[model samples]
Target chain A: MNDKVRNSLFYVGGTAVGFVSGFFGGGGGMLCVPLLQFGGLDAKRAHASALLVILPICIISAAIYIKNGYFDVTAVLCACIGVVLGGIVGATALDKLNGTAVSIIFALLMIAIGIKSVIA
Target chain B: MTPQHVIIIVSALGGVIGGMGMGGGTLLIPLLTLAAGLEQHLAQAINLIAFVPMSVVALVIHKNNGYVSIAKSAPIVGCAAIGAVCGSFLARYAGGYELRASFGAFLIALGLIQMYKAISAVVKKKKASKNKSAQIKVG
Candidate 1:
């Protein structure tokens, strides 16, 4: 796809994905990775983009959740710390690993989880 | 027809699905691979990015309604962040095609399982009601 087309699609798809993530708690990044990839982004780049993009969404959601009494400050803090650490580590690893292998494993895990969710 | 068109269509589609309480990853990832012709990793990454805003909105809504359950959400979010980072690193070394294929299979499997569970729950409920009715008649 041309740049213009791709860009537009990205925004549109992004909005939709955002909506879904908001409703289901699946985390929006999962959807972002695949869409960015299709939009011609490398895996690493896409991952980075996804992380950057999610920050705002997550924060907004957290705030709302907090306001409505759905957020546990303790949990959010702990989780944020863990995620920050993990994200740093992950970013470092991104340079060394095989993207395809990771994708396959990830996909398989998704399927397993999906199936379990469906069946159980 | 073009990638741009796909993006717009997909994004909007995702929003509606999200609004309806369905997970966007389920739909977005599939389209990214099949229609957009993206590697799984890229698609997933993109999905992640796109999901941020909507999730924030939802989270806020849930919090407003007092549905957050901070204690429970914390662990999950923490774990997920860690997992996401790990997954991101793995994406770097893995072949894009392989990643897409694997992720796709995983998702399909998961969806199937969830569907099965839902079905079973319904069926069980029916069976239980039937048994109860039978007992009532006997009495």
Candidate 2:
């Protein structure tokens, strides 16, 4: 497709992905990575680029949540500390874990939790 | 451990998964709801806030390595902002039970898709190795 048409289509795709991220309060970056790849980025680049796109979406959603009185100072503070610390470890360890096994485990975990969420 | 410790430990677990480039926040929400005794909205809010700083550090590293391409994403980002506003409103109005149920559905969908992708990748790898061995034998 031509650049104009392709760009327009990606623009629409971005909105859809962004909406999902916002609606879920997260997970938009996972969707965005593939979209960016389709938009011509390599895998590593797509992953990095996805963070850029997701950061803003996250901020906006958080703002809305905070505005609507959903804010929790202690919970958020604690969670952020945990997330950052764990993020460092995870990133460093990413090179060591076999990709296929980790992904499979992750997918299964998601499915299990999802089932529980639906039932309970 | 206290509930606060549970919260920190669980959040760290999710963060580790997320830092590995998987969607940790997805897992974090459910962990918070199930294990941490957080309400759905509050859990979601915490996840959203937590993502900002984590992503910032990751972004800087990725950018330094020349992995980011923010130059061409302006239009996409603009449209995404509009979509985010609409989505945030939708989530705000949706009750906790409804949001929880729908998030469950979304997780199921994503999980299945990832499973398929992971399985296919493994299969492809096996096939590639098989071909390589056959070639070696022939040689």
Candidate 3:
């Protein structure tokens, strides 16, 4: 896609994603990745882009939840601490791992989640 | 074709669904991938990107409404966030076929789980009412 088309799509897609993230506790990347791929992005690039877009959305949702009294500060803080540390660790792991293998493993995990969701 | 038009439509949809407590990622990813024809990883990436802003907004709303249990949610969110990073990096080198297949399977599983939860909730509610009426009659 051309820059103009891509940018436009990103904004449009971004807005929609933002709304979903706000409503659902889960992130919107599940949809975003596929859509981006459809728009001609590779899977890896799409993943990076999705994260970039979600960063702001996550912030907005967190803010809304906090304002509405849905957030437990202590819990949020603790979770943030863990998230930050885990991000670091995961990033380091990624540095040494093969991308395809990691993705396959992740895919396996997603399959499990999918199965569990269905079974439950 | 217009950015503004696309933005308005998607953001509005996202906000309404999100406000209603539906899982945004669930809806958005499908729409992006199935409807729009994006690759799976791209869909995930876009979903995450959009989530950042939406999440900030939602955090505020949830915080005010007291739906956020910091104590319980903290661990889950923390772990998931870290997991997300790990997951993202893993995707970087993964083959397209493996990713798509796995993602599709995951979606099916998630859908099933949601269906089960819905069914169970209804059942539990019915059972509780039945028990309550029985006790009342006995009394």
Which candidate gets the maximum DockQ versus the true structure? 2
Worst 10 residues of 3 chain B by lDDT: B71-80
Using DockQ as the measure, name the better of candidate 1 and candidate 2. 2
Is candidate 1 or 2 superior in lDDT?
Answer: 2
lDDT of 3 by residue, B1-139 (tens): 5433343344344344433333434444444444444444454455444444445654565456554434322222333344334344445456544554554565666555555555676679899999999999999
- Residue A3, model 1: Cα distance from true site in angstroms: 53
lDDT of 3 by residue, A23-58 (tens): 443445565555556656665555444444455445
Model 2: native contacts recovered, as a fraction: 0.80
Residue-level lDDT of model 1, residues A50-93, one tens digit each, is 54445554444433333433333332333233333333344346
How are the candidates ranked when ordered by TM-score, highest leading? Answer: 2, 1, 3
- The TM-score values for the models, in the order shown, are 0.52, 0.95, 0.47
Docking class of predicted structure 2:
medium
Q: Summarize candidate 1's per-residue lDDT along B73-113 as a digit string, tens digits.
A: 23224433443343444345566555455545556864555
Q: Tell how far residue B75 is off in model 2, in angstroms.
A: 2.3
Residue B31, model 3: Cα distance from true site in angstroms: 1.5
* lDDT digits (tens) for residues B1-139 of candidate 2: 8888889999999999999999898899988988899998889889989999988988999999999998755558988888888988888888888888888988999999999999999999999999999999999
Assess each prediction's global lDDT (C-alpha) against the native: 0.49, 0.88, 0.47
lDDT of 2 at B109: 95
> On a 0 to 100 scale, what is the lDDT of residue A50 in model 2?
87
The alpha-carbon root-mean-square deviation between model 1 and the true structure, to one decimal in Å, is 19.7
